[model samples]
Target: MENKKELRNWLNKMELAHPLVIAGPCSAETEEQVLNIAHQLKDTDATVLRAGIWKPRTRPGNFEGVGALGLKWLQRAKNETGMLITTEVASPTHVDLAQKHDVDIFWIGARTTVSPFIVQEIAEALRGTDKPVLIKNPVNPDLALWLGAVERFYEAGVSNLGVIHRGFSTYEKTRYRNNPEWQIPIDLQNRFPDLPLILDPSHIAGRRDIIFDLCQTALDLNYDGLMIETHNDPDNAWSDAAQQITPETLDQITVDLRIRKEEGDAVEFRNKLATLRTKIDVVDHKLLEILGKRMKISDEIGKLKKDNNVAILQTRRWNEILGKMILEGEEQNLSEEFVLRIYKAIHQESINHQKKVISN
Candidate 1:
């Protein structure tokens, strides 16, 4: 841990620039494909050329990347273009190959981030190495699990670490393939203030048409950089054709982003805003006081139900409460859906209290 702190300070001294762009094909399909895309991106503001050498697919018989052989292509691209190379490494052997080929940066994918065992193994391999690493959030929304992965890497002596917010899978159908629960990453920033956060706009948007908007939003939120998927020819790309952008499109997007920088005096306002949060703390205390009184009322009702041999859950009463609250909150400009959810939770908890009292 101490060494990790020392390394983090050293990294801070180096101070890699913000808005660092990482771009390449989704997968290194062939030597020519990998080299061609890298050459095209060479002129762009891309800080690192990334390609997936070993893709962990949800199903078999899909393009699972080119495996170990693809590292050679990435090496050649780095050698020719003088551009830093990055690739996803799923296992210790993958890390070994990346190190052997002198790969500049490595990222652990969302699928791999879900498993602590895999992350630990990869971290052990990275121990004592000076190479920089990027850890993506898991496919699911688990902030603790994501932080745990980062801690494991830090504990294993990998100090130069970064986070990638790639969005999370959700059941709801929406424009995004993964819902950008921006709050989770914002919370992560609070916990690790020194760590750099990058946005994986391609994964979040899941469509080329919306990539620029997502990237712009990420920048507005003060993210350190973006990781976008680029292919020389998106029409002929082997994986994620719909999400891949051509080199020309990538260049335009870069130019467009420069013209859209976040508006004035965020840093000074944020410092003063921290002091204003004490007001929120006082209100929070009052809110808790009100909730305590509400819970006491619920306890009294539970006792009444117990004495009368009445059922704990009254469906008609719950329906009435929900209907009334939804209408009332809507009149106050609150979302009806939000009111329904909050009231239902309260109703369920009230029933649970009644059950406990009756059983006693």
Candidate 2:
């Protein structure tokens, strides 16, 4: 994985006029159902049809996918519509089965990506594969784990690679079904600009209403493509019905979503952009300087607490600071979520500093 840029070779080979759209039902319910959705999406922006033949649900007795039988339906759909087909492969057996069915592409699910052993098994199973394989981010927000999964596949000599950002699981209640920690994917994209980055907004939104917004955000950030779960009858879909949209809705969403330019063309635009970026750099520098000062103050406080034989953690004070910061953050047009994440990181760093002082 030394040259992550090579991951884009498969995508570049396609030379698609529009962003790659992989759309289909969450699970392949039946041959008729699969073909019905495929025919509908065939006219849309969707370049690929995706389905789950063996869904590994969080719990049992919840329609654990149609198994290998569903692959037949996806094959039929591909034969009829001539669209590229993809499916999730959790194990080596799945890899063999999907290859047998001639699945055009393969994706590793979030749950599978969480486990190194499973990823290794699948990667070995897919060794020397010429077809594209997409790796989804892990269920939790662990970028290292996600990268490790990708590297495993790469090490196994599967160079045709891409990644899906399907958001991350969080206990906190929010409008989203999963927390869209945008920075994680952004960081990945920053480090490996050529690595294909696709966003699975269906899982992130968990409802049809906000899928458009999420897709728009991804396109605005220059995502390579999107994977949306779409069904002919979304409300009555067998699995993940809440997140599934109708093919018509998916078509409209693609039409409505805006894709912004990555860079300016005109000199005037470039000058303005450069000026704005300079201001951001200056602000970022100031923020780091302020953090340095804050850490110094934290070190002094840690020394005083050590001399007084007091514990490093002051839960009540931390809560009060967080509450006040949230209110002040609102006035500055900073979200409570942003304030919370920033302060939490700072607090952890302060604790680390205090720990060092206590140890000495």
Candidate 3:
């Protein structure tokens, strides 16, 4: 964990044109399937081929995975395509089998990353090896748990480490399969600037249509790489079919993506950006002042309601406020989702103030 420079060594070793691209099928269905996808991705931006060997499905009666047999397929694919092969290792046995088959890299999936015991087991299994390990974020949005998984690997002497931000699960309905609580990964980057952070747009999008945009966003945010699910025939893929894109589509997405520079050295650009940021700072301060004044009014209303013996939560009034704000937000080109989130937080704060007044 302390040796930050060592953790990024693997990424430094990779010779890639467009950041590091790890592309392959969601699951290794067969030797032919794995090999075909690997061959198609060989000439693309993808330098590492990833396939789920021991897939951990949410429910039973699904194609879990090809098990250890798929590792052989991955090995064969690597041999033919000359691309490094990677697979998900949930258990110590998986690590043993993957190592036996000469798999080049191992990634801990979201499910496995959530459990410290499993992560520890896999880390212990990989104790002496120097294989590059990529860990996906946990199912929930817990940054500490995700960082702990990485620390476990580092403690086990696995220095070649990276993280995959595949988004997080939430009960609330969202356009994305997983809510890309982008701040979590951004915070992680701020904490560990040396550790490479890759974006898993496939899991985050859960559909191919938005993968290109998501990739562009991640690249703009300075992610180290991307792990996209690419298949030979995406429509008929066994698992997560909707999220998988054809190898050709992946190629085009990589081509179309605009990778922005992290920072500019020009003094003029810096001055202009600083001026714009100062303007934003002023607006932010004014916004906070307005919010504080609104909360004071809310407290006054709460005291009035308490004196009148009226309920604090006026459902109809809340609905009206939300509808009005959403309409006004749309007029200003703001998304309903963004407006809802902002208003909901404010509403909760107001409720908290009312609760305190009522209790007193």
Candidate 4:
């Protein structure tokens, strides 16, 4: 594995004053469409132009990209617009073809990242290359699998690595099409601090209106860049129409988003932040202490239950606790979702404690 300093060479080489922007249509609909968007984006902050050539769709007969023909379109767009071109590569054939077409960057889609066999194959195909390969997080929110994909590339001697947080697949319907489990990428950031992290708000929002907000949030979280799907006409785009935005809208968005400084400029601000963080540390310590005491109480309750041969899980009690805590959380300015998540984990831990005692 490349050390931290060696891993960050690509980013250092860019020396961009602003975040790197990668923008283009989701899929190359036509030569005209690709070139049109590319022309519009070339003037904007986007340094890299992207178009999906071989889209991995969930089902068949659903317009699975224009194939190799799209690569020529992307190449032509790059030439005309003077922008770096990128495309998603799924198989070894895709890799070989992308290299032939002089694709500047390669991105491993979420679907391809899921399978070790495919990732390894593509990694080996891209072995010892200096191109910045951006790997999207797997379809599911598995950090291990995502890191595994990065590992495969590193093992293949590909060092110019980065990641795209395109969100993840989930059954629950929410505002987002793909749930932006932000913590998963944050965890990856914790492990590989040098890896350039980019946000694909286009996939996460699945709507044009919320793209700017997502982009702003990403910048606030110290994301290195964004990969937004831009088309000449978003509503009538070939694929992922809901998520795609127009080139004009993208231009406005790039202008509107703010890039905050990582560190406070003033000594006053630094002192205030340090004091606040110290308070947080104290509160965190107290929270742990209280949770430890609660667990000890749970242990006593488990012993009592064991003597009477009582079941560990009391669904009625859990529901009551959940309902009550949710109401309390709302009073304390916490969301119901946050309360439910916290309480559910506590309830599970309590159940485990009881199970251990009862089994003994």
Candidate 5:
């Protein structure tokens, strides 16, 4: 990964406003569709026009992009609108074709980012090119894998790099199409302070109604920009229609989003914030100590279970504990969702401890 200074230099070269927006359809259905949407997004906050030329859908028999032909449409759109063009590249061939079409930027989709071999191949293809490359986080919330992909690109002499947090897939039903495990990206930002971290709100939201709110949250979290899926007629779009929005709606979202300052400039505000942060530090330390003690007790229970030849996962007992905790958490002003996530993690750790004891 590039250092903060090097990443800052990359950002400076882009010369973008505070939140650089990249907007276009999820897929390039046709030349007219691509060009029309590009025209609509021309005056918006969007600086880059993006469309998927080679979409890798989960299921077969879907409107997988317009193939290499779409690159020409993207080129035409760029010529007409004067907007930089970007697209998802899954292979070395994609990189070659995109370079041939003079595509301004390239991003690796979540599916492609998960595979080291594919990333390496694409990185090899882009070895000498200085075009900006944005890598989406893997389908699963694996930070190490995501970081590895970025490092692979960086090692391959790709200096102009960025990351896209498109959220992570989960089997459980959620309000979101993918769970916006915001902490993963926030942790990434903490690790690489200068890395350009963009959020894909359309994918996270899965519905137009919540896109604006998701974009606002991302900006509030100090995200570098947003990549919203835009289309002329989203309701009848080829794929991911529910998540795509019209360019007019994209304009409104960008206009209404309030970008926040990274930190307060006032001395009093800084001093007060530091004091509050110290208090939080103390509370967090205490919380960790308590969790450590709980885990130690869990280890003891694991030993006892092993001695008694009892299974580690007592489903009935776990259900009872979860039920009790949810009610008690409500009294303590904690949401059931929050309590469940915490306990689920703790229970997994307890199971791991039991497994170790049983193995021994």
Candidate 6:
């Protein structure tokens, strides 16, 4: 691991065509898939090719991954194309294998990022190695946990540190598969001003159609790179079909992307970002207080509805609230659509509380 000064100097000297892309399939499904994409992307500016060798899926009986054998295929891709290679390392053994195979970069996935024990183990494995390691945010939106994982990697002596802002898992139904809380990564950059940050549009959008827009938005926010999933046949991909793009699609996206400068000194921009975040913190606290009051009122409503044996789904009341809130949001320059979505969630929770009260 590089110390902060060493890492900054390395990033500065890399001469990356701002917004360096690092793309490949979600998993190296086969050698053919890896090679085909590698051939297609050979002339492109992607600094590293990423693929999942050990996919940790939630359910059993699904396509877990090709395992350690896939590492050989990645090495082959690097040998054939002369491009750098990267893969996710979930365990100390994974670290050992990747190091043994001369894998250029290793990323800690969101699933592994959530567990301090796993992060520490991986860190320990990487203690003597100088491999460039990227840490993705945790599956949930826990900033402290994410930072801790990065700090661990740094403590372990890995200097080429970076972060992949792949969005966060949430219960809300969003157009995005993962909520692109752009603010979270921005907050990260504010604290670690020298840290390189990349965006994983594939995981965040979770649909090919939205990857372009997400990439554009990440660029607008001055992210350092993109880690998109590109497969030869997205529709027939073995895993995450909706999120995978064809190599042709990724090629088009690269052509279409516009990289932006940070507008000013990186540190200055981060300080400004911090000021905006401080404002968000104040507003968020007030919003939570209001939500607490609203829940209290909801409890009262629940008691009344239970006493009257009324069903929790009061369509008329919901319609009124939605209408009023939408109008109010528009007046305040908030996206009416966004406000409606938030209120709908709050309303659903209120209904759930009422139902529970009625049942008990």
Best by TM-score: 3
User: What lDDT tens digits, residue by residue, belong to model 4 across residues 1-360?
Assistant: 443344355546654334779999999999899999999998888888999999889999898999999999999988887788999999999999999999999999999999999999999999999888999999999999999999999999888888899999988677889987776776787798777889999999988889998887677666788999999998898799999988888889988887655464695565446545644554575477678779878999999988987887888988888899999999999999999889888888888887887788
Candidate 4 regions with alpha-carbon error over 4 angstroms:
1-17, 262-360
The C-alpha TM-scores of every prediction are: 0.73, 0.75, 0.76, 0.75, 0.75, 0.74
- Any idea what lDDT model 3 has? 0.87
What 10-residue stretch in candidate 4 is worst by lDDT? 1-10
State the lDDT of candidate 3 residue by residue for 1-360, as single tens digits: 433355445556665444789999999999899989999999898999999988899999999998998888888888888898899999999888888999888899999999999999999999967888889999999999999999999889887888999999988677799988777887798799788889999999999999998887777666778999999999999999999999999999988987644355685565446545644554575478679889988999999999999999999999999999999999999999999999999999999998998899
Question: Candidate 2: which stretches are off by over 4 Å?
Answer: 1-9, 261-264, 267-360
The clash count of every prediction, one per candidate, is 0, 0, 0, 0, 0, 5
| Residue 286 lDDT, candidate 3, scale 0-100 | 49
Q: How well does candidate 2 score on lDDT at residue 313?
A: 97
C-alpha RMSD for every candidate: 10.1, 9.8, 9.5, 9.7, 9.6, 8.2
Off by over 4 Å in 6: 1-15, 262-360
| Residue 300 in model 1: lDDT | 90
Q: After superposition, how far is residue 339 of candidate 6 from its true place, in Å?
A: 18
**lDDT winner between candidates 1 and 3:** 3
Tell me which residue pairs clash in candidate 5.
none
Instruction: Tell me model 5's lDDT, rounded to 2 decimals.
Output: 0.87
Q: By the TM-score metric, which is better: model 1 or model 3?
A: 3
lDDT of 5 by residue, 75-106 (tens): 99999988899999999999989999999989
Give lDDT per model, in order. Answer: 0.83, 0.87, 0.87, 0.86, 0.87, 0.83
